[model samples]
Target: MTMLEERPLDEPFAADPATARRQAATSPETADRPRSISSRTFDDRMSLGGSAVASLCLVWLLYTVVLPMSGKLGFVLLWFVAFVLLYAGVTAVSQPGPVVRDRIASAVIQGGAAVVLLVLVFTVAYTFVRGFPAYRHLNFFTQDMSSAGPSDPLTQGGIKHAVVGSLIELGIAVLIALPLGLTTAVFMTEIGGRFGRIVRTIVESMTALPDLVAGLFIYAFLLIALGQERNGFAAAVALSITMLPIIARSADVVLRIVPGGLREASLALGASHWRTVWSVVLPTARPGLATALILGMARGIGETAPVLIVSQPSAYFESNPFHNPMNSLPLFAYTGIRAPDTNSHTRGFGAACVLLATVIVLFVVIRILARQRRARDARPRPWTRLARRASS
Candidate 1:
């Protein structure tokens, strides 16, 4: 019988990086070009266009002459239904049963996605437009609302307090939740037992827990039972409760995607489970972990009820989360928008814009870091370079 070759300890996760790099000069992401390879035929295009036009005509006729429906939303709904039926009918005449079904499905999917995208774009655009005046003032980023009244100009008061409070609260929440969630994820993924399964079941259950209930839980436990003051710390704790399950669930999924081969290799090399996870699994799943962090942060950062319930709103800035009252963007926006004044409305819109921008920026920054990590992994290691030079 032929002898079997064993993998070296140093190269457990993958084969020699030097060999792979030398075999291919460019990374897959760098080498590949994106080009659509859709297989739509002329008849397919004709059927789609004809159906859309016919649907619009039919819907318009129904609204104007047949139906009593006067709402734009109802018209759109009817139009979509008409289009699906028309498209399927038209395709069924010339194409196979499968093709007709596929065409109809594609139209519905595209239509649904278009509606969502349109709604998203409109919302962002509307908020920006409404908040343009407030965003234009230099004081909007520098000043707080301590001295400004409701009738004050956009230039007089700003969301500075809300911004600072949100940062402090979210920062605290991240610190508390990240490690706990990471540990929980590791327990569920690497050291899975009956306890781990129970933890997973609880996490999955909490994943759908509503924002209001999270606030109420914290409110009842900390503010009422423990007699804790309404402050940024309480808000942060509430936010952590909201964030914990999200982070744990997301990290669990991410860690689970780490290859079984890598885990087995690590074990075979005499590494303990903890060491294997720390050195191999965690590092390998870094990007996904970053995504989990983002998801957690995104969920908590914009929470309104938690902040509303457990924290006292303040117009002036508060630096300490453990100290007196604080305000966040969502809370600030909600209060401002509900007030009966144009200035408050402008401030509310501006806060909304800022909140949106914050989330987008955070997402972009983390995604960039994730991309950098992937790119670094794709690059040949230092020892790989040394080995290549010696081999050459």
Candidate 2:
């Protein structure tokens, strides 16, 4: 055939006149209609500006004229709802129905997130503002509450005892809960059986166990039954009860997500099951495990009821957890806030700020540790580097 009459090898023939006509009719240029309102188009920007102005005007009218005349409280909630509705309606005038719906949904989700973030920021700001008086004093971190009376100045006393006690108790709780929780998690993930299932169920159930109930259990067993005095040890035990379930549940989830191929590969290399878990599985999931432990510590650190029930709130500094009663940040804050004095109120807010700072510091430290571990893992070992150098 001549070149002009030959069909190209890659292109298909339409085979019929009707098919060719249909293909021409459905070309890219005419296949789908262009969007009336697109984010990429300048018209979208104009529509957005129009919607904003209309929403503001509608909200102002409702708040000032309609609500006031109806004897209704013209709160910000009414304004917000009016703004959302008016904005959606105004935008829908130029956009397709589906695009307007999606935009409205996106606005609601983003607005909700912004409101939550603002609430958290304002709460922290308010606490710091109220606590500034006590926090500004050098004595607040150095002296104990023993010498400070109801009318004493903010500079006279500090939360030294509470701070020390809280740290010690939290340390003890971590020491006790970490091993048990991690072991339980390992068993749940690696040694699946009826017993493991039972243990998992119990741990899951304990997640919702009340803080007050845990405190009462410890208080009755130690103080009432054994006739022991209120001390930091008993408080630590109570906190451990609170931390155990959280750590176990979190760690179990972390361990379960570890790739099964790593375990199989380790076993293929002639490692025992326990050795494979220790040398391979655990190392692979270290960051997640650390995160679990941090979460558990956060829950334990903020507990007030357990410490309140088991340990007497002491104003004097006590170093030994075994001997005398010890105070903690939560207990101190609770007591101070209930007092009738302004200094006590300031101290209460200050204690709360310290508690928040402690949690933030712990989270930062743990994140740093996890990042360091990941970086170390990413680097080659000394022996591996030496071998590579020799080969080169």
Candidate 3:
């Protein structure tokens, strides 16, 4: 105290300005800068504005540049960029104090990256809006591709054959893959030992194998066994193999996430492990299993490589699975690309749009079913009270 007083008195004690300000604003003993109200407000507002602008710029860029130009890769990139920018902006805006300012520039950079994504989505949408009007009719869905010729501009060729082929193949593949995949998943999740681990590793690795490889494997195996060439049945087998790995992995993950407590409770009640798994575990995981099946079906339906390798193209409709080559939506698109006229091109685009629509419809149906199931489970049960009464 004595030394401080002496030092201060030397200059008439004008008071070290920073020290005085700090003492008045916050801690009397600590040395720090006192920020004015206007300065703090300005900094905060500037940061918020920058963040907003950055977010908007990112969205704008994505819609304008990347979507229409990039195909599948572009679509994925746009989604990633859009989500990242949006999350960054939200985080920046919600953060407390000075740290909020730091994220603004980062937001700007991310936003810039999103510009290409914006362009891509917009271009695709624009193309759809323009071309969709040409094929948006019931005639497109109800007719077969057989009646139309290469020179016919407005003739009545329908997607019926292609639709039938797609549905049949998809159905067969789903029927074959679901049970096999579900069984494999159950084994991997419930069974223990080195054997289970090996099986799981093999399933996981199969998920990464190319569709063409799966097609070739099936083609070679069947060709050797039955001494026959590729056909619709062959295509279905290939699709099943390709889809099985994905379904198994997804279902395994879902089952593994189930709580051990549930399993223990079922077993403690004298339920066999197999019974508990089938009744309790599977019922609980039904939604995930359905989702996996849907994904498998979708993948198999759109697979061009396996279909191309195993099934020959058909200009005419063939209802018999074994007698003739099956013409699917994917194969139809492939054929259209090689056709030497405007009619073929139009049909290709229309078929593509329909295929895309079908995938979307399946996804929507799954979502609706999931929601309904969830709602049913969420509702209070009159049956529970009835059961309690009966027991008592």
Candidate 4:
């Protein structure tokens, strides 16, 4: 065959015969042609909305009049079920399978998102409102529960000891877990030998390890076998164990997502593997690493079982982890809720609010730090600034 004969013809966009035919068929100018099945017209939107409203009203009527259900929870549940069925059935009548499927997916995703947002808002508001009496007290942050009984008024008792203890234990766990997790992650991503595969498997397995089991592991080995006392150190150890797998797993995933080209570029420029990872890969994935750390912190900090099993609860404020018992927000909340008094319940809710606040603060701090670093990196360099000025 001659090369000139086989040469391709130059054409405008969408100039293929098949594409041209499709465009003509779907064009608004083509009056006799049917509209695209996936296209959502105004009529389609109206039909979908009407279907949803009709389903909701039908569910309400059934729940209130036809059914024995009187609770808000049941009403909402029935509405969701009815809405899904009615919406799908109604859409299928006027639309093709793809359109029906798309509408159903949109409805489910939007409905689920709305429910989750509402639930989260309600939970936060309820916790803050319920804990108002105790949290609003002037001495709440300063006083300890040592001298106060469960029946004592909110004004007389506080979560000072629990707050301090939680911080100390969390600090210890971070110190122990962060480096180890990062090391494990680096090993997995940078050096994936057979041993690395084994390590990855173990980390994944630990991620599903129950909180109670982690507590028991530390309790048996650290508290019993070693003849150690129930203290904050033991609790920190359990928290570390829980946090380690989370941090390592999340970090490994994040590091793996770092662009291989960046690593290659760094190495091609004569950087060692360690230097490339430390300077290029780690810095590139900073935000994700921070997120991984946050997940680990959240998992460990809020654990009640491990702390409860491995560490004794203390009413008095203690600073030394090596000494007597310590108390954390989760443990304090659990114990207080179990006490047979309204005062104790208030304390529990108050501690929960504090725990929530602490987590929020940590999240904000990490986000701010990550953004700040990114902002600095994005700032114009000296030569870039000069070039911009010269251009302007």
Ranking by TM-score: 1, 4, 2, 3
State each model's C-alpha RMSD to the native: 15.8, 8.6, 8.4, 10.1
Q: Report lDDT per candidate.
A: 0.87, 0.86, 0.74, 0.88
Q: Which is the better candidate, 1 or 4, if ranked by lDDT?
A: 4
Residue ranges of candidate 3 with Cα displaced over 4 Å: 1-134, 378-392
- Lowest lDDT 10-residue stretch of candidate 2: 383-392
What value of lDDT does candidate 4 attain over all alpha carbons?
A: 0.88
- How far residue 112's Cα lies from its native spot in candidate 3, in Å, is 9.0
**Candidate 4's residue-wise lDDT over 152-235, tens digit each?**
777897999999999999999999999999999999999999999999999999999999999999999999999999899999
Native-to-model Cα distance after best TM-score fit, residue 375 in candidate 3, in Å: 3.3
Q: Which tens-of-lDDT digit does each residue in 7-122 have in candidate 3?
A: 85433332665444334444443336544433445545565566556655675566666544545656555555565555555544434344444454654576566777888778
Best by lDDT: 4
Say which candidate scores most in TM-score: 1
Q: Write the per-residue lDDT of candidate 1 for residues 243-332, one digit (tens) a residue.
A: 999999999999998899987876776667777788778988999999999999999999999999998668888888777889999999
- Model 2 scores a TM of 0.84
Pick by TM-score: 1 or 2, better one: 1
The ten-residue window of minimal lDDT in model 1 covers 383-392
Range of the 10 consecutive residues with the lowest summed lDDT in candidate 3: 383-392
